[model samples]
Target chain A: MDEKKLAIIATKGTLDWAYPPFILASTASALGYETEIFFTFYGLQLLKKDLDLKVSPLGNPGMPMPMGMDKWFPTLLTALPGMESVMTSMMKKKMASKGVASLEELRELCQEAEVRLIACQMTVDLFDMDPAAFIEGVEFAGAARFFEFAGQSDICLYI
Target chain B: MADFDEELDASGLNCPLPILRAKKTLAGMESGKVLHIIATDPGSVKDFEAFARQTGNELMESKEEGGKFQFLIKKA
Candidate 1:
């Protein structure tokens, strides 16, 4: 039987938004599926050589406040200075305690599993992002290139 | 108890880590060799079943002990 294929379009770059694409791609590859992740717009940030991903609590009603402060924590306070850093740190600590893999670790696993990491060239040109800023082994391509592979995939997801 | 050629302890790790580690271990084993895995993630029960099905490996045994989940898979 032919190997199954999975194609993913990653469009989000936030800390909370990063896990789905990498996790799914890596897992699918392990399941014996050929997998590719097309990084576009903000999602291209994930391919950076140095990752400094951060999460924000503002307008995120679902985010539970840290240190047992959930019930009375004011949404307006999320807009205050340095709130993003505070929330990001809290989330990192919480994930560490839960034994969740970091984005780097997941991405590395994907690479090891031979999952293709494609960076959208248009986004790179539009954002003026330096090509050298991205990690090695990334393929830069256009939407047409992605569609060529995605069209033949048994599963295609936009995340 | 099913005999296993290799053992993987994936306690505390969540979601795909356990499955990913098991796949890596199984890849290094000879065909028909059994891989014993112990994972703490509840999601792994279903994940391992699906993994065995999708990868064509045989899940020789699966059960819970105390608070942990144990699985024995024969490499395909």
Candidate 2:
């Protein structure tokens, strides 16, 4: 049998949304699958050097309130300035306490496992993001290049 | 219990960590050597099964006791 391959498209830029693609890609690589992640649109923010990722609760009805507080509290807080950054920090702390790997650690493990991280060239061009702005080991590729890998992948995910 | 060449305690680690650590451990071991892993995550049950299937490794034993999941994997 041929080797299994997984291709993931990451389109969301939130700190919360960043975990799935990286975790999945790294796990797939550990499982002996050839894994690739195509970062597009806002997702390219994750590749930014020294990026301070944040999550938005303003329009997210599903965003959980801190300390099991009333939903209205979080809703009201979201309307206030700088609340998203507060929530993002709290979320990071919560994840750390729960033994979840930080985004940086996960990315390092992915690199060691040789899971390919591909940035969407079109998005980079649209955002005027310099290649030097991205972290080391990130590759730039177009949608055509992404589809080439996705076409042969056993699993494809849009996260 | 069968003899295992290595033992890793992955309890309290969440999704993907246990599997990733196990994969790294297996990479440094000789073929046919068994690795015993104890994980607390419920997801590890499916994760280990899938890991073994995809990597062509032998899942020699798997059991759940005292809310902890145990797996013995032999490198291919």
Candidate 3:
């Protein structure tokens, strides 16, 4: 039987948004599907060597307040200085306590599984980012190259 | 207790971690060998079933005891 393939386009850069692509790709690989992720736009941040991903609660009503403060927490407070860092630390702690894999770990698993990691060359040049800023084993390519693989994939997703 | 060739303790992990660990363990085992797994995530019940179905691994047993989920998967 022919191997199944999964193609993904990751376009977000926030802390919360980083998990889906790596988690899905690694899991898909574990499920015996050949997986590839094309990192474009803000998603290029995920490929950087230093992962400083943060989550901002501003304008996000769905963000639950920490320390049982959700019921009465005001949205305006999320705009205060350093609130993003506070929320980011809290989220990191929560995820660590819950045994959720770190973004780095998941990405490493994807690499170990041989899931193709492709960086959008156009986005890199447009943002004036150096290719060396990314981790090793990343293939620099464009939309056409991604389409060559995605067109034949059994599943394709944009995240 | 069904006999198993390997044991994977995935306690405290959530979502895809448990399933991923199981998959990695199964990959190194020979076909027809049973793998016993213990997980704490409630979602693993359905996730393991779906994983087995998609990967062709045989889920020999799946049960819960005292809030922990257990699964015996025979490698395909």
- Using Cα atoms, each model's DockQ against the true complex is 0.93, 0.83, 0.86
Tell me the TM-score of each prediction against the true structure: 0.97, 0.93, 0.96
Per-residue lDDT over B1-76 for candidate 3, one digit per residue giving the tens place of the 0 to 100 score: 7899999999999888999889888889999999999999999999999999999999999999999999999999
Off by over 4 Å in 2: A74-76
Give the Cα error of residue B29 in candidate 1, in Å: 0.6
Pairs of residues clashing in candidate 3? none
Q: Give lDDT tens digits, candidate 2, residues A37-149.
A: 99999999888877689887788888776766536564666778888778888888989888798888898899999989999999999989899989999999898999999
lDDT of 2: 0.89
For all predictions, the C-alpha RMSD in Å is 1.0, 1.7, 1.2
- A1-159 per-residue lDDT for model 1 (tens digits): 589999999999999999999999999999999999999999999999999999988887777876756667887887999989988998999999999999999999999999999999999999999999999999999999999999999999999
DockQ for candidate 3: 0.86
Ranking by DockQ: 1, 3, 2
- The better candidate by lDDT, 1 or 2, is 1
Candidate 3, residue A120: Cα displacement in angstroms equals 0.7
What is the fnat of candidate 1? 0.88
Sorted on TM-score, best first, the list reads 1, 3, 2
